[model samples]
Structures are given as C-alpha cells and as structure tokens.
Target: MRIIHLLVIGALVFAAAYVYRIKMDSTARTERVLRLHAEIREQRDAIAVLRSEWAKLDAPLRLQGLAERHLPLKPLNATQYDSLKNLPERPPSLVRPGDPDPIGAMIQTIDASADASSVTGSVPTSAPASEGQQ
Candidate 1:
C-alpha cells in the first residue's frame, strides 16, 4: 500500500515538472515575440525618417539650383527655330530601273512549282474543281 502511494506521488511530481517547463517555454516565446515586434517598429520609424529626408533632398527647386551652379546651359532663342521648308531635298534612289526584284522572282517560281505539282496530282489542292472542268 505504501509503495502504491509513493508511485502516485512520483507521477504527480513529474507532471508538475512538465507543466512548469511548458509554462517557462511559453513565457520565453512571448518575450521573444515582443522583442521582434519592437525591432520591427524601430525599422519602420527609421524608414519613415529616411523617406522624409529623401523628399527634402529631391525637391525640384534644390535640384534646379544645383544644375544652374554646376552646368553650363543657356535659355532658348526664337532664331534657333527653323521651318520644314528650309530643309534640303531628299537624295535620288540608289537602285537602277533594270534591276529585277529577287523576292518577286522567288514568289513567281514557287507559284509555278505549285501549279505544276497540282496538275501532275503529286500534291493535293485545297480548292475544289469548277463544274465546267468536271
């Protein structure tokens, strides 16, 4: 009877230890989550500050002032503009009149071969024969 009692007490102690360990682990995880959230918030604040500074630095007036100080530029003048009629005439064609088009000759050769093949019944034709031919 005493041995049974001791065994029950041992099981109870072990269960308590397990429950304590689980609770400690939960608390540690909660603290880690809080630390991560804080770090994320800090990063967001830093990004916002950087964006604000970028907006100030990228102002158009500031950039225009910098350009005026560093670059050698002048304003436009009306005399600089010219009409289309003042442009020179286009040059003459480089190809001679007697030169035959190679692409057109190739297309004609293909058409002739196709017609010959259709007449010889070596190749099938997509178009039906006319009633007068039949």
Candidate 2:
C-alpha cells in the first residue's frame, strides 16, 4: 500500500511538471506573437509615413512649380502640325531578303552555349588525373 501511494505521488509530480512545461511553452509563444504584432504595427506605421512623404513629393502643384522653374518653356499651337501626306516616306528595312537574321544567329549561338553549360552531369566533366600527373 505504501508503494502504491509513492507511485501515485510520482505520477502526480510528473503530470504537474508536464503541465507546467506546456504552460511555459504557451506563454513563450504568446510573447512571440505579441512581438510580431508590434513589429507589424511598426512596419505599417512606417509605410504610412512613407506614403505621406511620397504624396507630398508627388503633389501636382509642387511638380508644376519645379518644372516651371527648371524646364524650358513650351506651348503647343495648331500651326505646329502638318498633314500626314506631307510626312516623309518610311525608310527601307535594314534587313535584306534571303539572309539569315543576324540577331537570330546570335541568339541561337547563345542558346547553344547555355545548353552546353546546363549539361552538368554529362561528358563535360574533367576526367580523373592519371598516376603520372599526380
């Protein structure tokens, strides 16, 4: 009967320890969650501040004032436009007929090089040195 009582007491102690450990773990997790929430709030506040600053910098009146101060004057008039028929004819294409495209050839060369570089498991590996070379 005394042995059984001792065993019961040991079990109770173990149960208490396990519950305490669980509670401590949950408390740590709760603290971490609270920290993350605070960090998120700080980041949100920073974002709001940045957005407000950007809004101030991007105000149209400020941009217009800067442009007026720095840029050369320009105002369009109807007289500036010309009839489409008066426009010069389109220039001839630079690529001659029946010739392989230079850009395409270069692209093909690069693609071939890429394929070679991608063959990591193939014959491109350096062979083992011979006994004399060692």
Candidate 3:
C-alpha cells in the first residue's frame, strides 16, 4: 500500500475508536441518569408514604381519642377559679437586683482555670527509629 493510503486508513481507525469511546461514555451516562431518576422516584414515593403516615398519626381526632382513653382529665367547675385577692403572694427573688450574675461568674472562673495555652503529644521532637534500624 502507498503511504497516503496507509495514513488515511490509520486516521479512519482512530476516528472509529474515538467515536466508539464517546458512544460508550454517553450510554453509561444515560444509564446513570436513568438510575438516579429511578432512585429519586422511589425516594419521592417513600416521602409520600411517610407524609401520609404522619398525617394519620397527627390527626386531631386520633389524638383526642387517645387522650380520652388514656388521660384522666376532669371537667372544670366554677369553684376552680378564685378571686385575685385569694392567690398566694409571689416569692422573693433568690438573686438580688445588684448582684453580679452567679452563673456567669462560675463560667468565667472555669474558662480562666482551663490552661489550654499549650498542647502536648501533638508533634514529636525527633523521628522514631524504623524496625529495620532497630
């Protein structure tokens, strides 16, 4: 064969191989996209099922029925309420108005005491000997 014919044949083979690679890559990507879509559909179906279950669980009538069956709740009577004068006096505050916050003071003391100024075992001053060296 002549040099020109051989070069053309080689170029044709290269082009065919390149086209085949591209086709395979596209097919793989298409299959991946289809798989992802199937996964998304399944997830959406699962979400729908979960939402329906939640709706059933959270229904007011269901909760009310459960409460009625399980809770020993009594109906209110007029005697349950009392005049404002009959109520107990409010207790005095444990913390004074001008006192520094006790919790804040404790937190500050803890932070000051925690000596994290330096770290140990973070790095070695010298490399350890290997097994062969030993």
Candidate 4:
C-alpha cells in the first residue's frame, strides 16, 4: 500500500508540472501576438504620415513651382501659341569693322568655315595649339 501511494503521488506531481508548463507557454504566445499587433499599428501610422507628406508634395501649385525653378518650363499662353506661325524669320545683321558683335561674328565665322570646308575638302581649318602652362 505504501509503495502504491508513493507512485500515485509522484504521478500527480508530474502531471501538475506539465499543466503549469503548458499554461506558461500559452501566456508567452499571447504576449508575442499582442506585441506583433502593436507593431502593425505603429507601421500603419507611419505609412499614413508618409502618404500625407507625399500628397502635399504632389500638390499642383508646388509641383509647378518646382518645375519652373529646376527645369526650362513655361506656362503656355493660348494667344501667343496660336500666333507662332506669324513669327518673323531672323535676318543676318550688317557687319561693320571693329564692332564687337560677338554673337554675329561667331555665326559668320561658323558659316564661312562650313562653306570653305564643303568647297575645299583638303583645307586645314583647325587652328594650331599654342604652348601654354597648365
């Protein structure tokens, strides 16, 4: 009888320990699930903030100003665009001696060089490099 009672008591203690371990495992799992839920909520809030900022940046007026500043873009005028075909062709300016018309001189020089090059295929058009200190 003593031997049977000792065996029964030992079995009961072992069963109680198993039940306690199971309860602790379940509690740990619940805590982990709650932590994940909290993390998901935080991510959603961060995404909302980012979306709001994006919307502000994408506003039409702000985007237009940014384009004007960074890119060579202009607002179209309907009347000016419609009359584009009537625009006058630019004529060559009268060249006078010793006049510092840099743009006109450059245009004349390029045209003359091109005509000479086409006429005489063997013309040494390139200027020789001068010796200079770097």
Q: Could you say which candidate leads in TM-score?
A: 3
Please, what are the lDDT tens digits per residue for candidate 4 over residues 26-134? 9999999999999999999999999999999999999988988899966677765646577798787775665656775575577566755374544355533122111
- When summed lDDT is taken over every stretch of 10 residues in candidate 3, the lowest stretch is 124-133
Q: Work out the TM-score per prediction.
A: 0.59, 0.62, 0.63, 0.53
Tell me how far the alpha carbon of residue 79 in candidate 3 is from the true structure, in angstroms, after superposition: 1.7
RMSD of 3: 17.0
Candidate 4: segments with Cα more than 4 A from true spot: 75-134
**Which residue runs does candidate 3 get wrong by more than 4 Å?**
90-134
lDDT of 1 by residue, 10-124 (tens): 9999999999999999999999999999999999999999999999999999999999999998999999999999998998866566765666567446756764545655434
Writing each residue's lDDT as its tens digit, candidate 3 over 1-134 gives 69999999999999999999999999999999999999999999999999999999999999999999999999999999999998899999888888766776785566556556532545332444232233
Count of clashes in candidate 4:
0
Give the candidate number with the greatest lDDT.
2
How badly does each model clash, as a count of residue pairs?
Answer: 0, 0, 0, 0
Order of all candidates by TM-score, from best down to worst?
Answer: 3, 2, 1, 4
Candidate 2: what lDDT? 0.83
Q: How much lDDT does each candidate structure score?
A: 0.81, 0.83, 0.81, 0.77
Per-residue lDDT over 28-101 for candidate 2, one digit per residue giving the tens place of the 0 to 100 score: 99999999999999999999999999999999999999999999979989999999999999999788887667
Cα lDDT for residue 91, model 2?
98
Native-to-model Cα distance after best TM-score fit, residue 76 in candidate 4, in Å: 4.5
In model 3, what is the error at residue 133, expressed in angstroms?
Answer: 81
Which prediction has more favorable lDDT, 1 or 2?
2
